[model samples]
Target: MSNITRPWWKDAVVYQIYPASFHDSNNDGIGDIPGIIQKLDYIQSLGVEVIWVCPMYASPQIDMGYDISDYEAVHPPYGTVQDMEVLIKETHSRNMKVILDLVINHTSDQHAWFKESQSSKDNPKRDWYIWRPAKYDSEGKRGPPNNWRSFFGGSVWQWDEQTQEYYLHLFCTEQPDINWENEEARKAIYQSAMTSWLEKGVDGFRIDTVNMYSKPMDFPDAPVQDPSTPWQDASLIFCNGPNMDKYLDEMNAILSRYNAMSVGECPATPDRARVIRYVSAEAKKLNMVFQFDSVDVGQSKPSKYDTKPFNYTLADVKGAISRTQSLLDGTDAWTTSFIENHDQARSVSRFGNDSPTFRTRSGKMLSMLFASLSGTLFIYQGQEIGMINMPKDWDIAEYKDIDSQNFYADALARNPGNKAVKDFAKAGLQHLSRDHARTPMQWTAASPNAGFTGDKVKPWMRVNTSAQDGINVKDEDADATSVLNFWRSMLKVRKNHAEVLVHGTFQLVDENNEKVFSFVKTSLDGKDKALLVCNLSDEENRVPEFEGVELAEAMLLLDNPWEGRIYLID
Candidate 1:
């Protein structure tokens, strides 16, 4: 193997903060940029090198912050533009980098550009967004241009009565897709919005739905293969389209000029070959890519919203992780090692035991697994303390995520008076609701707002009451054996052995063992090797004693059932 120079971000760990749920400053009931500023020390203490703040940009809050209205300005509830500047400066002062979540696939319908585009068919900005004439049947009945459906359900095309045309929106109707085919629109996005932020000194950006920017020139009607979700497999039409590489090359031209890094949030088929092309050094597109293989393990056929028995066995977990590690082992493209984020349920609750007896152990085990991987590690807010899913039995009224609400509505409307649909929808919510991850951060146990906001204001989202009892930061920080400390310790270990964990070669050990998921990582120099082992089950299990390896001389890293141990192999 040849020696390769690694980038600064390769050895860094990112902590994702859902801005709305992090911390509410000024008693506004909503978290703001200033609130993140207040918690800088706490974040730094966790040993993360990059803070990825989920979009705090101006929006109508349709799909949370993903529906970007004003890219250059901060949302009013999230503080002023000045607050964002302060956040950047404060993060830098702490010797850490800041990654802003950039949503460029679409823009809020309320954006000035979109508003003007819809004013008239011949408006100068009319071509800024995707527009097509409504197709008519033999009876002259008006309908959508194609059978493409929105990710949020219903038709992707929205009819504009005033303009007498239909605009494409892959997400909510309020989020109109930008016309990437339009050279002017592409220039505006790259020059105006992205460049403005790069100049603001942000380290990099996490591009949301990066692959969905380009669309095929010929709009084709999607075949209805699954009635549950006709649009689930329709990603090939929009994701990684013909002009995707061209647009990314242009984006890289701008990003490389600033010497910045880019992590593309691409949800493509779990094909390593397809993903590596996006972030390969030769590709010059992105610094890393977040794949959905691990997160989409138990997703049923056709639709992710459809409820499936959560009987995902240990083999399924190992297959997803090992396959990714094996494929990207010697490649230039870097993988993002993450268990949970703003879009998924809490990791402990999803993959491990969230019960009081094993919450800490399971959380620590999952953390150790990702930390020892051969790429950048991401820790979502509250993940450090092993935050579990939202409280059980919570009603739909308590959920605020647009995706969940839309899924429920579609399920109900599709099968009115059908108890099966209602039961399935509720079951899906219990296990897969985005709200499970969007709940307010539990900072302290005491108070009406869990110390996330002042006593008078109710937080935008409900705080997990379970967190207050035993999982809050205040409680975890004081306990030496807490999951919080384990995370800090694991992060410190990764930093201490950057060459091995960040750029090392990954090899799975005891591949067929259903009770233990273990691997050995060798440093680039091949001088230092670390063997990490974990007990995947709740019951006690023994780590297989390898034929050529000896443990008597090994240094035990973690001594627990969930987090087994990491030894310095001779």
Candidate 2:
């Protein structure tokens, strides 16, 4: 790689492309490799330098492409390995780097390795997965080996009649945990999984649940929260275990050998000190770690954050992001800033004006905030069009994400019954469904299906009905002042002022601006400066705090001033 292209990652902007919904290559009503090729120009026009393709691997898609059956092949639905090579080559030709989603924590139970691992106790690969004998009561009633809960809403175990033992699965039962403690398993995963892809000249990885590679030796009973619930396992016990660094070191050594870039989707947010230490420059584990404090904005007591209802005023969002930036200061703790991805609700629906009134400004507010932060920003598919959370009126069957569906069913299973299950159903659709984001990209306003794929054939997931009027990408692109343009302008500003935005110290300007989330980013010399103020409120509101700064040439850098504006203060 040329020096210019080699270090380009440090300055590159990563646009996350969800392949299944990015574009339809064969008009098969699903996005594919050829479609990604067709859309490269569009991505380049937006000035993106990296394309983070989120899993195009062969799998049962038990966790929507998170489970891997074949580490080195492409799913037939997406295309051939040749197609991926073409995509990578085309991306490189356009000066854009390519990154793949590295899911090493677990693999499809159908994977040959897992199949062999579960064959019998005497199998050579028997210890290649987290397997244990089922627990039995005095009466000989059998249950999971431990009281762990699967994230998909069940006990984290599946009984195997062949071996008369249960295997653990943190996600769907079809996806079992890989025993990283097994040297053969680790070497197989590293060589066949990371090394092969890295050798293809692709950039690094986004390690899915990276910290879950390690586990607790004793599969203990979980503490009770909602007691009537059948099971619970505090993820902390197994995730980010005592062996975290050892595992990361090994993973990093391979990635480093290939000079690849890496980031860890670490859900383990112990504290600022812990986060800093884990992501610190000397760690040699990853380039960055995605702290979900922003995404998981669910309500929590200071001591615990798992109960949900992450209600946040604009002030809360500002505070959380501001604090995260502060912790990463003076350190090499790179961050992955984003609004929507495979997890969480869409930003438009959750924060901005998905409700019709505040959509444009609110969407603009979130974009400006995340883009301005000092980190490698990841703009999820359709976020450029300001896609919102799923709507309440949609039928329950429209859902495809197993987790949210499981959550809804589990919420309904309580004996005395869940309070406001209907409200939660409404909120879950509006605030947490991954299906809200997997819908096809609305590329053209005039065509049916908004030219995403086509109404002629059904999309795997139901397209958001709102795409008809408000969310078409073509319409927004033509309208220079559209929410899409706000994204364009924000990218432009970041590129123009890269030094101040990417390396400057980030400080929250006003904590009490309920409507305006303000921050000032300053260069080392303090000569370079930029002020970001976003209006997250529904109605018109001026930034009461930034009103003090006197200006000489306050050019309007960008504005969604339906009640928010970004003035280039002089």
Q: Which candidate number has the best TM-score?
A: 1
Error of 1 at 11 (Å): 0.4
Candidate 2 segments exceeding 4 Å error: 1-7, 299-310, 415-420, 546-548, 552-556, 567-570
* Model 2 clashing residue pairs (backbone): 23-31, 298-310, 299-309, 299-310, 349-388, 349-389, 353-358, 353-359
Model 2 lDDT, residue 270, Cα: 60
For model 2, the local distance difference test gives 0.77
lDDT per residue for candidate 1 within 1-570, as digits (tens), equals 234566889888999999999998888789988999999999999999999999898888989978888888888999998898899999999999998888888999988989999999889999999999989999999988888867777788899888788999998999999999899999988865789988888988999999998888688877777766535346767788889889999999998888888998888646678788888888888888888778877765344668654747778888888766664667777777888999898888878888888888998888888888888888899999898887777877887888888888888898999998888887877777788888889888876677889878888887788766688899989999988999999898888777777677888788888888988898867887888888877788777776577788777756655456777665
- Model 1 worst lDDT run, 10 consecutive residues: 300-309
Cα lDDT, model 2, residue 376: 78
Error of 1 at 350 (Å): 0.5
